[model samples]
Target: MTITRRNLGLLGAAGAAMLAMPSVVRAQAPRVVRYTHFQPGRLDQPKHAAALAFKSTLEGLTGGRMRVDIFPAGQIGPAPQVMEQLRLGSLEMAVVHDGGISGTYAPYQVFSLPFIWENQAIAWKVLDGAFGAEMAEDMRRRANIRLLGHADNGVRHFTNSKRPIVTPDDMRGLKIRVQPAPVFVKLVESLGASPSAIDWGELPAALAQGTVDGQENGVTNILAASLYQHQKHITLNGHVYSLHAYLMSDRFFNRLGNEEKAAVLQATEIAKVIHRGMTTAQDANAEPILKEKGMTVQRLTAPQIDAFRQKAQPAVRSWLEAEIGREWVEKLLSATRAATAG
Candidate 1:
């Protein structure tokens, strides 16, 4: 065991190798992101399609330094549970509907202020601008979730088994199922329908079992969930321009290197565009899609839609002003006006 010059040199080389091995292993190991959304994993489904694009694009961008494992159709859990996981850093990312986002950040419900966005373009302008940035920052501060981007959840319209809702009066005395968010409940109540708060997982069963006569959703969701099979009628009132928010856990995002973060942000923008395009196409062709599915599709006149808006907007705005704050409600209104003008 006497140390010679050659033996000492060999020991030093082995020691250096041992020290470098850990760093090499760490560099070679890919960071796995658990991404989830509440849509079927089929390519036809918007969320899944976007998710696939994100996975491929991000992996390519990072040259395999990152790997995304997607859990579509709520494979891990329902929206609320998935969101909780995201907040706690058990999950890395999610594309969640506004209703689910509202559960974590109540200010998100301001987007649900019934008939706020006249069209998708205006909605996008508002969401991609300063107001959306401000809200994203606030959400990060409050909920520890980073808003990557906002995409269309589709323009929500009313669907019923009993009758076609041509006006606010037609919605009266109907039991309409809505997402489990207070703003939706208020919106339905304001329009005179009895709103039943149901989780997305339970909605199809609720319609089939007559737990609720009808429900409201966008074209993409109707096609995704097959809600059109149960609801014989749909009113394309475009009452609410819904949103699917791309979210990442602040804990996970902050841990990434600058290049990785940039790749993630760029990949999310790509996915957001795909999501919005698919959903927007479905919304634009809603009438034909529903009619082809054997559902009675009702397209309301601007005046008819105006009547519903006048009735429901004020009521929901008042309720929201009390719930979140008048400042948020007013901020959205002002943004909408500016976006519309621009």
Candidate 2:
């Protein structure tokens, strides 16, 4: 029973009634939800705030029927391992970056395609529109997981201590730190950098000890992690838009009474709003704060950015086709273009 947008309209009416069953009502009276994130208690850490907000909203929505137990700072496992735990039903819920777990659901990589989103507003519209909902349905079918929705982490920009990366030629020969994921490594390598796979937990120390000369991330992340202390310049390459997911195990969700299930989904949606608001707000305020902390933020112009896309797109798109399917990549690109225009 694969879900599609058309079929969902029919099922939704029938589903709504069952979603409020008495057994569900009873079960959720003492339901427990386990949530986790790698970010600690920093005001700039949106995931941390999303966890707290979800707990407060879910319990309130359920009239104290559900209790949320959240683990912060990667207590259970690293970023890549969490999705497997969710699929096996060992973990209840988690907020994770789409890039880290796209191996399990290759279609999710559609969001991580470099230079796809022009800005957060356009990205937000697509994620909140039918496309995001459709993607969530697809994930449920493929990976037995529910994408609660997209959460913003800001635009990912390049940072380097070696030299200013104004163009693709500048990225050459610089060994940059990359997430322990193939797609990210491929993106950096496509741009001519020596991509080194690194865990998020060790990035701070890696930077501090000069293990890696540079990396790419959002302004909010750079400031929050104090990466400015290691990397001398921030090039607003804005290469990729950073997106995280508020994910739940479909198996676990399916086992719940309808009302309990809805409660959980509703809570996840609330967290999405919290996550987006905090992260975007952080990015909005980061320029001044980053300047105060002595980090130089450089914005690239059209000609320079065109040079980057031309150099990197062929390799990145080719890799995408190899990993997934050519047809799928074409579909995603088409949808993104449509999303962009609208």
Candidate 3:
């Protein structure tokens, strides 16, 4: 049909509207981030809670210019996979533990050593101080991840279906599931238990089927995974004071504007406090809860814990020195001692 003047005017308007839409959409779009972790999305769980805190704070601080989408409970895959995603900038951020991060950066195993800290106060002192800053920078440079803060995995303890662990001698022949990390393998073996390197996803099944008679983890982890249903006894040997590394993809971090980077760091600091408090409270309150669930929970006396520490320390330290360099080991120990000194 022949076009009229009025029809030509209408067609011109429609074409202009279409041409302008792309710029409008780009102007209104928010910068999105994908954050993930292995923990379940329970309000009481530290990682999930912390992620929520970050999401809320970041959106508020950025006035909705940034959006953080959280995926919990291995929604993006296990810790190692998530870690790789973070490295490749496929994932924006994650709260990964020593077990997950160590696979990429071997020196992270330094934190997995047995009895490194006598208590949380000293551990926090070192980690929140300059030493921790140095370590974070080292990770940023070497591993392509930015360490935002350190949260707790709680101090790991031993639990077994076989018997209560009073002494290192009691661990003999017991097949104990451990994170698939050499430091953990060495820690368990040095204490005389046969270490079965199992992925966290498979641990509950491993315990339930007696594929492994025992495992060592924080009380929160034991409770969260319902390992108590399978394991009858728990020994709070407190061998390894584990940590959660709150990390961001270095690629994503480097691309952020100055104000956006500042807001992200501030939000993480806020989250670090919330996360650490939750885990600390869990460690304090878990014993009674475990016992009420009908599992025998034993809190090791000072000497008993010391005994296990003595047994595990030499072999594990030697391994660390050999594997990660004596210089780094000594440097960490020096920092710990300085933190502990009055």
Best by lDDT: 1
**Predicted structure 2: clash tally:** 0
Instruction: Assess candidate 2 and give its lDDT.
Output: 0.80
lDDT over C-alpha atoms for residue 154 of model 1: 89
Candidate 2, residues 1-342, lDDT tens digits: the string is 789998998789778868768777786477778888877765458888888888988888778777889898789898668988888888889888766668678877756578877778888877887677888898888888878878876778788887777878888888799877787888999888899988888898988888888998876667667788998877877678888888898888887777877877787888888888888876676667667888776778978887877876777888888887787677667767887887
Question: Which stretches in model 3 have alpha-carbon errors above 4 Å?
Answer: 1-17
Which tens-of-lDDT digit does each residue in 135-188 have in candidate 1?
999999889999999999989999999987887888889999999999899999
- Tens digit of lDDT per residue, candidate 3, span 1-342? 999999999999999999999999998798998988878899978889999999999999999999999999889988888888888888999999898898888888888778888888899998888888988899888889999989999879899998887889999999999998999999999988899999998999999888999999997788778888999998888899989999999999999999999999999999999988988887887788789878898888999988998889999999999998987788789999898885
Which pairs of residues have clashing backbones in candidate 3?
none
lDDT against true structure, model 1: 0.93
Better of 2 and 3 by lDDT: 3
Q: Count the backbone clashes (under 3 Å) in each candidate.
A: 0, 0, 0
TM-score of decoy 3: 0.95
lDDT of predicted model 3: 0.89
Each prediction's whole-model lDDT (CA): 0.93, 0.80, 0.89
